[model samples]
Target: MAKRRFGRVRQLSSGRWQARYAGPDNVDRPAPQTFDRKKDAETWLVQKEAEILAGDWLDPDAGKIVFLEYARSWIEERPNLRPRTVELYDYLFRLHLKPTFGARALADIKDAHVRRWRKDLLDNGVSAVTTAKAYRLLKAIFNTAVDDLLVRRNPCRIKGAGQEKSPERPVLTVAQVYALADAIEPRFRALVLLGTFGSLRWGELTGLRRRDVDLDAGTVRVERQLIRITGQGLVFTEPKSAAGKRTVVFPELIAQDLRAHIKDFAQDGDDGLIFVGPDDGPLWNSNFNRRFWGKALTDAGLAKIHFHDLRHTGNTLAANAGASIRELMDRMGHSSTRAAMIYQHGSHERQREVADRLDSLARGQLKSGSGTQRARKPKKAE
Candidate 1:
């Protein structure tokens, strides 16, 4: 019963070894539970001592911080995050995470809790994609807690819980694209053309100015996007990534249409907005989606088509036009290959074209061989 150098271990009446250590606060604390053997208890004490020496030791009681408090603090401390990204994280917390684990202590969240939360989300009619996003957000927050030594390990270990398996979106054909452009109001026709041909995003298209489009040069410069942050209204910020800042060549097929749109619809001055609503202000996706997008689709007889599908159409067309992965990435303003690769998948029609070409080549070779065999048959024994 002599005092040890760092801590002490003693056998309880039940023959289990118990370890106690003096924490950084100078208060003696017992291990959460008893160990089966004295060796195990001694090993645990050694780790605790090492953690103290390395200044990585966190008071066990500190892990009891409420989940919402810690998560909010974690988000607020990231001043470098983009405004839109911060907005999304905030939304996810409010909509998905807060109702479930907000009141729970950070250390009280277990693997079963996370698993049940995910299952409940799915059972409550949440789409699998949304559930996956929520799971990923939770996993990321818990990972940071682990690094801070707030927890021993992350409990979001459910396999494939963080992946989003979105179904393939429908891509508009060339004729459908033109029909949609024609069906929309004359002032907004150019928006459809630019979205479908240039593969521009909603924000990028709305962020355009008179000077951004060059009819003579057949190019459109994407320098910035207009993002509507919560309570901040519409603010102009640079592209989400370096690749997003690009110059896309507008197809000559839409040159006349774009020229007419600029002359008739674009605001006055070089910095004037190119695409605006009926009130001549910047176009907001919410208003557009509510007012015009559905009408345009109905007018064109295109069912189950979303406005963003126009961009998908453009990317698919670009990939079918023999664009390599890097070219597709540059055109789509994606910093990674995964999205560009998805667009680069050979279209059914393009795959059919490949098969047809191979069949034609085989037929031509067979015909040539037959002619050679007839020609070398000693002139038909004449």
Candidate 2:
């Protein structure tokens, strides 16, 4: 390989001091501007030389594609991405990002542009969390452009970049959970109960096959999830994370329900879905929610709650049962303990009980010591 070399200061025909350098391919390249003096030219040459040695130099003008064009190419290149992930990326790009930065050249984009866009989004009644997601999507796109040599750096790296904190989830009472479970139709009874006890995600619960459950062992193996993506209907995929692939041991009531479920409504084959449509195919999540979930809540006379809240209810119940943080984390298949902690915040009554127990134990110990001191008449005299 030819050793990179810096061009010496030379007076241009326009009476300006010019600096040049040999690129990696041994091609001579000139600076965009000529300096007023040899010192200035030498300073420019030194900076360029260092950048070239560090392998951080780019032509800047090369591949100056517009953000829209680069984004399309980026999406196209991700052939191995999950269908759901691709759908979300496409939606984010088209609905949120492209309208803002699509026309701008990748090289011309800067951190200030991103900051301004974020401010505009927040001003337009968009939640901080939404703005943060948009920012993340833009950052990912620009990072891809950088990787593909379409841009120098990601402009989304401005300080204080991230989504705002979401609202805290409300914990449902045990009475409310049981009431909802009771009001739901018999067909969906097991589903509601399982969600309230197992904390299984909607997809994971819907994706369960008969063979994945072992009623005798009182365990349900969660190995897959059913995802419905835009432009693609229903597809079964592995759990979102390794932690999502777990086995949850249900209580005896749940185990008995499973056994009965197998006997009464079980499909012909072991591979048949535990939850299916009237046609015995995979159930559509939207249909299930609209047809059954809403009526169940209304009948139960409870505030309208999301189907996913059952999972939260399960976590709360497990914590109230004195299950440790690690055990709750395992049951919920949470990738991080942080998320499990959010669900483990039990009711105020439970908190008070814990405090009372500790206080009573302390008082008992003090009383015992006091009795011991009184019994030691000689020691008291001393």
Candidate 3:
């Protein structure tokens, strides 16, 4: 029968105290269980008020949203995700997150559930890398759900679960690079050459146009990348970052090969496709690997080498050629910059100078024909 400062408490006919308060949503919320005494009811009201004042109070019913529905909406709402990124997220959700958490409400999901899901993925023979990707996607989705007030907190609290610990890729020697190039079909020889010497990504290679490559300048411009979506065959998209829209100077020594590639393989016109499949269609990674890359690796006598490793080898060659990290970032089209590097992109001339050094290094490595530098062991107890 008495009015409390925070909430009004009423003594029911059953001699129990019922406490009710107006929530931030302007709707009255009653305590789930009534208290036996006035003091207890008052204490409940005080705690609720404290939670509201501390900005830690959750809307009681907001988290009733289903995880699947919320996640779908989240993907739709994200404007900045690339098509390939959207495809990847969709794949992860379908394969990993959906079966376990899709039907559950946002509030019902907990950290324990997340841990169990991740463990199940690993137990079922999912690669650690794939599991980490799934965990990161789940964490990102829950993060947005929290911000949108759909959940009180993100349930992805496991430490380092989202971090990927993939094994280091093998880097090929200069001679091996040339061998792989020669072993591949003649048209694709330049593809492998540019992939290494120009440090171009697969998408960048597939997306190349006649105009993108400047043989006279000894440079290749990254205007866009060709990405393949599940339902969609191929789509050309602009670089995601300003850094990706860059000019990467390749060694002049490789220009003759490039010139021949363009004359023989590239489609007509300045805007014509530079590197097309035998059918003149944009190169599909799977098809290329099966039809060309796999056999080339066999012929070159290299094992466990990835196509992307070409770029890695180029990066290493550049570093060994005395290229600064900033220069590497510039050539690699890395959007994220290191603190010491400060995103200071080198001038075209500076890049060309680095390219020249790369040329010298490649020549030396080709002459030496060493795949790996073997470290000398010290004599024991001499």
Candidate 4:
């Protein structure tokens, strides 16, 4: 056979065309199957050469691994992933990704399949936010696969499909915050107040120690959080990011409430838990929400508002108090300004005040102009 430019296409003894080429590793590998036509074999060699040139060539057999196995390994081998994050990935895989792509080979999954799966999820009443999460996880998994040369290209190509559209929650006024604080139990009044004023998350609030709260300094040092993992009770771990470990100063209002809470409810020693159950043991979010939070909401007449919204309320209040973007990010324990921007947006009342001020300015200018014209009038030219 004549020497070809990229690879040789030779006729096998069985009368089929076979393509062979030396891969990037300098290994001589042949086509998996023989082509009936010489042109088809030549085209296959052309693609192989193009892949090699582009540094995207992967062994055909490498991507044959089942997606379920590969995805599980990916999640397990992720470095520095938190326990809660790992749990969420596992759940999302099992509930959303596994059933659709579990048995399929990694290479066989394509953009069309992803689009179909997302459509089916929405058709079956799955929330868009949840579907977005699953899509993002799948994208991450495939991204790893691409990096490992297990797949040539990622299939998650739907634009904006991986971005979650979360609905804005209601931000409580300062008065409403106090109302909820008064409605909750004495021991938990500080929880409501801090969640709104200090912008502390549930895990941070539950994880606080007496030593972490400095009444003298009027600041709380957030260092750790209490996260509940499945098959494990509650584990205290450092905050997820370096930015999460912050020192947030509380106003005198929050300080006074904290003092009362410490005197009436917090544990005795500095090492003791600050927020606990009725028995002074560590409080769980589930227990608080089920046993206490729901009743407090009803009593405060703020039904349908989630407890997490209290943190949002606090961030909004801080923004209203002229907290800058960086200050909001620091106070909210967020590593990025994206979340801070969301919290720093103008309130409806603030927007209304702007319009009201503009109207007053326009009316004042009109009255001044009319008076000047009247004063300039010369007795009807008499």
Instruction: Report every candidate's CA lDDT.
Output: 0.91, 0.81, 0.87, 0.90
TM-score for candidate 3, please give it.
0.83
Model 1, residue 148: what's the lDDT?
Answer: 87
lDDT of 1 by residue, 181-298 (tens): 9898888899999999999998999999999988899999999998798898999999999999999997899999999999999999999999999999989889988889889888
Q: Indicate whether candidate 3 or candidate 4 has the larger lDDT.
A: 4
The true-structure Cα RMSD of candidate 1 reads 4.6
- Indicate which candidate wins on lDDT: 1
C-alpha RMSD by candidate, in order: 4.6, 5.0, 8.6, 4.2
Model 2's alpha-carbon lDDT is 0.81
The C-alpha stretches of model 3 lying farther than 4 A from their native spots are 8-19, 32-41, 53-55, 338-382
Where model 1 places Cα greater than 4 Å from the true spot, the runs are 1-6, 9-18, 34-58, 361-382
TM-score of each prediction: 0.88, 0.84, 0.83, 0.87
Residue 351's lDDT in candidate 3: 78
lDDT of 3: 0.87
Q: Which ten residues in a row have the lowest lDDT in candidate 4?
A: 370-379
Assess the local accuracy of residue 173 in candidate 4 as a C-alpha lDDT between 0 and 100.
85
Sort by TM-score, best first: 1, 4, 2, 3
lDDT of candidate 4 at residue 156, scale 0 to 100 = 98
